[model samples]
Target: MSVRGRRASFISAGVRFIVILGLSVASCWPFRQSQDIEFTFLLPPGRVECFYQPVAKNGSMEVEYQVIAGAGMDVDFTIVSPHGYLLTSDFRKSDGIHTVEPTEEGDYRICFDNSFSRVSEKMVFFEVILDGQGAEGGGDDEWADMVEPESMLEYKLEDIRESVESVHRRLERSRQMQTLLRAFEARDRNLLEDNLWRVSFWSCVSLLVMLGVALTQVYTLRSLFHDKRRVHT
Candidate 1:
């Protein structure tokens, strides 16, 4: 081939290669989903509820809970490991988070206790997230077979996804915190109402007692001061 013709051929081949690589990346984009679940339930007085969550060894399990409504807006919480060891114990807590790294590969128990409550049913909100460390980097070697630029782009995309996921998680945490604040406000309001009612009731009782004493003394004094007109006619 002549020099000018060879240059034109090389340019066309480069353009074709760029387009093919773009299409390939577009066709096989990688995405992984993290596990997260939330639940809300009513816990009746004097009852205990337990949930079993399966986690692999070295994996992390995160749990968060809030008591939205009840007499004291609190409940007893416990976490038990698969090997029958106590992992966490919270007594009459309103809201909190607990994270555990499992040493045994089996089901872990999470229990909510309303046994100390006798009058009110509790509304509990809980979230469970499993951080699967075992799956990370399991597929990275496949990217090594690709060209360096392609591999770098893929990793960057993965990092972007991670950042987006992190933002989403923060938003969720904010929402949960707002809910917890509202619940606390409600509990305070209820306590204020009960106190007001008690004060009013006691005031009324005191007023009635004072009135009775006053009337009784007045009648006794009038009877003692009666004129001596027993034998007029």
Candidate 2:
């Protein structure tokens, strides 16, 4: 539009940027913390894990996982939803940390399933560290207290029971898949074995046919030679 209007727009944009920067700096100052949560579960089937983490609106989790185990089996992770939906992996840190930012606010269950191979020892051990929450406002003690601490994430268990069921359903699905694969392999092996004797029998018959053809050719050649000898005589 007009020069004055254009100037006003630029000034307005600059002011908004300054305001955002100021708020960001103030938030980093940090005052109080919400809560700390920590809990562990012994996986009956395989290793499963969950940690309360605050993810950015567009960033990874505010809480990060650090896994340690033999062959990192302690870190072998499978994620599932309580609603019978499978969760996908977003990112894994160099230290075998997993992080994801949820776009929706609701109950989410992540299972660290290691129930693939029966031979594999059902071993999965892992822990996570949580950072504080973030928003445009500076975290006040009142606000922080309203939130849960990173260390005390156990309270979510009661709140996430349905999520646990979701995990169970996912595990069931995994089991089904494994069973199907095994059946397929068995069928393939049986098919191969069933045809083995037939294949061998046919191969022997073909060999016999070739031998007979050779013998007939030899007899025909001998007869021709004897005729020529008689003519020479």
What tens-digit string does per-residue lDDT give for candidate 1 at 108-167? Answer: 999999999888899888888786545444444545554455433234544434555566
The per-model lDDT (C-alpha) reads 0.76, 0.45
The count of residue-pair clashes in candidate 1 stands at 0
Report the C-alpha lDDT of model 2 over 4-34, residue by residue, as the tens digit. 9998887787666655544543444343222
- RMSD of every candidate to native, in Å, equals 7.6, 18.0
Runs off by more than 4 Å, candidate 1: 1-32, 118-120, 133-169, 175-233
The global Cα lDDT (0 to 1) of model 1 is 0.76
